[model samples]
Target: MASNVAQFAEGEDPQQMSSDTAALQDQGWALDTDGMGVTKTFHFKSYFKAVAFVNLIAAESSAKKHHPTMTMRIGSVDVHWTTHRPRGLTHKDIDLARHCDRGAGLMGAVESGQGIKCGPKN
Candidate 1:
């Protein structure tokens, strides 16, 4: 059976999600209090790379039908994910986050100072 994020509510007991949150946070994601969202920052060596990454994320967001609030600066990109319809966190948010992480990982992006690359090496 698939897990439903709607089963959880904001400001309620987050014990069940503590571990997941910890893991994601360790990957450089943080919670957005006001938006009830999660955010992650990615640093690139150049402005063009940063913007390209942001564009990649934007394309993915549109494909997923879940959009994140993004801010792209010279050398950094910040992405915040949340469920705008219900106005809080959801499994969709978490799933989308993981997808974003995977996409970043494929591009040789670093998260929390660690380089992440997806897929097994043949």
Candidate 2:
């Protein structure tokens, strides 16, 4: 399991997040900024594949004791990761995002799409 807790000092800068977000994006992960926490979405080819990807993420998140909001759509699975208790993005979030990226690659899913689309209102 990837490390859910990272060495983050207080008052992390948004620019730092941009850099990390870019890195994750390059690896086929979508980053969401229009919320209290960071979100990412991964696309697959079929419902079974999508569910399988979610299961892998579930195991990883459970092992870390950190969870993400997950959604299953036609041929896709969206995962939003953030440290809600603290109300901000953290290294843990980025780490999980990276892990999700790796899982996507392992499953032969290409990360190519528009940036995260805001989910339904509230």
lDDT of each: 0.67, 0.67
Mind giving the per-residue lDDT tens digits that candidate 2 earns over 58-122?
99999999899988775677787877656666777888888887887776564545222335533
lDDT of 1 by residue, 17-48 (tens): 55565667777777775536788888665566
TM-score of each: 0.70, 0.69
Q: At residue 71, what lDDT does model 1 achieve?
A: 85
State the weakest 10-residue window (summed lDDT) of model 1: 1-10
Model 2: how far is 71 from its true place, Å?
0.7
User: How well does candidate 2 match the true structure in TM-score terms?
Assistant: 0.69
Residue runs of model 2 more than 4 Å from their true location after superposition: 1-18, 28-36, 111-122
**Distance from true position, residue 80, model 2, in Å?**
0.7
lDDT of 2 at 30: 49
